[model samples]
Target: MDLSEILIRPIQTEKADILREKNRTYEFHVRKDANKIDIAKAVESVFNVKVDSVHTVIRKGKAKRLGRFESQYPDRKRAYVTLHSGHKLDIFEGA
Candidate 1:
């Protein structure tokens, strides 16, 4: 998969914001098929930062019922990228 497609978007919740400030790891909503190596490369290429490691998780979809219809949310993937010490991604800087 392309780097751009691998990285869907940054998770901008309160927990993610706190981690960004106090931790060296950043969370991203990534492609379902992307692996750790791909995630690491994509993060490094897109953010211009040095990546130490990448961990991924598959978020299973949830089933819901509305009226007489049943629907399910799409399954997705997430990547937690740990950058090398003294390095940080500038995309979220000043935000």
Candidate 2:
């Protein structure tokens, strides 16, 4: 997969922020078909950081209903990338 297509977007929840601050880890939404290696390389190249490890999770979509109609959201893949010491990505800086 292309580097640009591997990572969809960064996740910015409160929990994610805590992880970033404490563990030097960042979370991102990634393509479902992308693997751990791809995610690690993409983060390193895009953010110019040294990635120590990468963990991924697949979140199953839940069904939602509105006035007798029901639909399910698309499944998503999330990647947690931990940077090596002294390597930081200023993704949320000044935001």
Candidate 3:
């Protein structure tokens, strides 16, 4: 898969911010089909930082009801990438 297509976007929530600050880990919403190696490569190339490890989670779609109709949200995959020591992405410095 193309590197650009591997990572969908960064997940910038309060919890994610805390993880980045304390654990040197960054979270991203990635393509459901992408694997761990692909995510590591994508993050290394995009951020120019060495990646120590990658952890992934797949969140199942939740069902919601509108009146009598019910529908499900799309499934999402998340990756928690841990950077190597002495490396950091400036893009998230002010975040």
Q: Which of the two candidates, 2 or 3, achieves a greater lDDT against the reference?
A: 3
Clashing residue pairs in candidate 3, if any?
none
TM-score to native of every candidate shown: 0.90, 0.93, 0.94
State which candidate has the highest TM-score. Answer: 3
Reference-based lDDT, residue 20, model 1:
78
Can you write out model 3's per-residue Cα lDDT over 1-95, one digit (the tens) per residue? 79988988889899999999998999999999999999999988988889999999999999999999999999999999999989987877785
Expressed as tens digits, the lDDT of each residue in 1-95 for candidate 2 is 68979999999999998999999988999999999999998988888889999999999999999999999999999999999999888867656
Q: Name model 1 segments beyond 4 Å from true.
A: none
Model 2 stretches astray by more than 4 angstroms: none
Q: What's the residue-level lDDT of 7 in candidate 2?
A: 95
Q: Lowest lDDT 10-mer window, candidate 1?
A: 86-95
Q: Count clashing residue pairs per candidate.
A: 0, 0, 0
Clashes of 3: 0
Clashing pairs in 2: none
Top lDDT model: 3
Model 2 Cα shift for residue 26 (angstroms): 0.2
